[model samples]
Target: MEAAIKFEAHEEVVSFDQEGNVVVNKESHMSKKLMARRAIEAHRERKRLESELEDYYFEEM
Candidate 1:
């Protein structure tokens, strides 16, 4: 027989992953959206940096 898990009325559900980090099972929609937005921002920053480097090289020639 397995023991039943319980939670307090006001407690939020929490779990852990393989790495032992605290994982929140809720707010999936918000988290996914935030992750995607961050990824796009990182990509844009990388491209801007690359463009600046290229311009610098061209100017020196």
Candidate 2:
């Protein structure tokens, strides 16, 4: 079977499998600056959660 998929002009078509799965290209969608910002935000959130957990653990001791 053949299928046609339409996307925006800025969108990149990575690949389509026989199982009807559409794979998007990450590199084309995410810029280095955006990726760095996301990484930093994730790291900060992780650190905050870890600190909270540590504080709770110490308080319970």
- Per TM-score, the best of the predicted structures is 2
lDDT of 1: 0.56
TM-score of each: 0.51, 0.53
Candidate 1: list runs displaced more than 4 Å.
1-30
Task: Give lDDT: candidate 2, residue 4.
Answer: 30
Give the range where candidate 2 is weakest over 10 consecutive residues by summed lDDT.
Answer: 1-10
Give the clashing pairs for model 2: none
In candidate 1, position 6 carries an lDDT of 27
What tens digits encode model 2's per-residue C-alpha lDDT throughout 1-61? 1233234333543444576344445655567575556556655666699799999999999
lDDT of 1 by residue, 5-51 (tens): 22332234344468644455464334566545655665566669979
List the lowest-lDDT window of 10 residues for candidate 1. 1-10
Runs in model 2 lying further than 4 Å from the true structure: 1-28
Error of 1 at 12 (Å): 24
